[model samples]
Target: MKILHLLRLGAFVAADKRLERKEIDLRKLEKEYEEEDDMELEDLDMWDERKPKQGMDTRKLDGRDHITTWSEAKKGQQLGMYVNTVPGLSEVELKNLFDLWQMNMINCCNFELTFLPLEEERMLVLLPDGKHLKDFGTMLRQDKNCLTFVVENTHMLCGGHPEWDPKRPGKNVEAMEKWDQYHKDKKIEDTKKKVEGWKESIPVENKDEL
Candidate 1:
């Protein structure tokens, strides 16, 4: 009993240490996020000539038309990477997790996530380049909790966000359905395998006894 108590205490201490380390990491990431928020990433002096914006007249058009001005988009031409956080994470918690992921991926690729006001759960990651997408994918697999994926074909997104169309399904909506189906199928397959194993484990005489 004494040995068991000592082992339990040791496990608690180890868990506490892990929690402390995670808290410290979060604090550091928060500080970095604050600093990065202040610094706007502008065109570097070393960059060569880029495409100029095509000007168009918009004297009296509806704001809903979307193409209001000739001004360039804030996030230049970058690859749109999407992550569906459909697991009931709050806005703040999701942002902190994304910030932590960004911190983990230092020196690989520089990018930031944009969460739409309407679609808060889906994160729009604007990757500046495609060189590190695979690297990020490898790291993503290590994080069993992270749902990092690119949904294709089933539903469409407008401007890196899902549009609520009465006619068509939204992006992650279809993706989530597919995910559920995948898990359901896997469960059935696993159950079958377990049944086979159990059948093989029974004695040969017992197999006939039923």
Candidate 2:
């Protein structure tokens, strides 16, 4: 029993260290995301080199062949099954980061978080931005999910040699662009519909006059 406990503790420690490293990467990502507008789209420097799997092509993935699997896997992580626990940031904020990292389209779905454990028992806090993060205290009060561990098969995201999928694109600015385009298109479509409605409301001869 003691041996099992020690092994579990060790794994947790390793995971914590990994999370810490990812935090540094996150900061770098944030900086790039902040400055992306000034950058040229053709620049390959925008890609995160760490994404490609071991023994795979060392170059940036300029093609779409490997990106799909990586994208779906990340989406799975963002919308994890059964439970979701975010430490400092609210659940939505963290998931938003994941989505942005993937450069995926905005997925505005109602997240029905079922529970928030005691502060100490909650997940470790990694990224905390008092200025940027929104208050989700109401979510905590309303949450109701059961707490449990989830095992993930991450090998798919970063495939080995013969297999391949680079890491998350780490291009949030690009992702935000997707949202911008979606909203822009929706606005245009809505305006068209509104004009059609107005035309219907007014008589055909009146439409020609005013």
Candidate 3:
């Protein structure tokens, strides 16, 4: 009877210990979730502080806000991304840079980014010419989806052989001009056809009504 009593006590102790362990694990999980929520809230506040006000044309390019993605690194790191220039710079300057950049690197989506080996962790902007970009730099690490520029301080600016997409055209000033002219002609033709349709649709007022 004493042995059976001891065995029952042992089983009760084991069950109580397991319950205590499960409670501790649940508390740890809850704490982790709370920490994550706090981090997200901090991020939102930081973004609010850094973000520019609406209607700031200079801050925006081609009706889109200057897209800046933050680094997910434990320590702060440079960040960069590729984007097509829908309407970049003044029309003349845009064309000039486009031509120059195309000559150097095969044009992808209007522009390709290149990083420089800057010893200092300050921002490095990739421009068509060696001119400095105001607030941009290379991110130390990136996810697989991103296209990156291999930085070399010795090489010239915009030095990148980015991944290729066959559908885009290379540097062709004549072709662009032709394309612009074609669009203009099409617009004029479309307007003329609309006007003719309107004229035909208009019922002639009876002479008696006049």
Prediction RMSDs, each to the true structure: 24.9, 20.1, 18.9
What lDDT does each candidate get?
Answer: 0.49, 0.36, 0.36
Count: clashes, candidate 3: 1
Model 2 worst lDDT window (10 residues): 126-135
Order of models, best TM-score first: 1, 2, 3
TM per candidate comes to 0.34, 0.22, 0.21
Candidate 3 — which residues are off by over 4 angstroms?
A: 1-169, 206-210
Better of 1 and 2 by lDDT: 1
Among all candidates shown, the one with the greatest lDDT? 1
TM-score of candidate 1 relative to the true fold: 0.34
Cα TM-score of candidate 2: 0.22
- Model 2 alpha-carbon drift over 4 Å, by segment: 1-171
Per-residue C-alpha lDDT of model 3 across residues 93-210, encoded as one tens digit per residue: 4445435544444333343445432322122434442211222222111112122222322111121214222233121234446789999999999999987787777678633343
lDDT of 1 at 136: 54
Error of 2 at 134 (Å): 26
The prediction achieving the highest TM-score against the true structure is 1
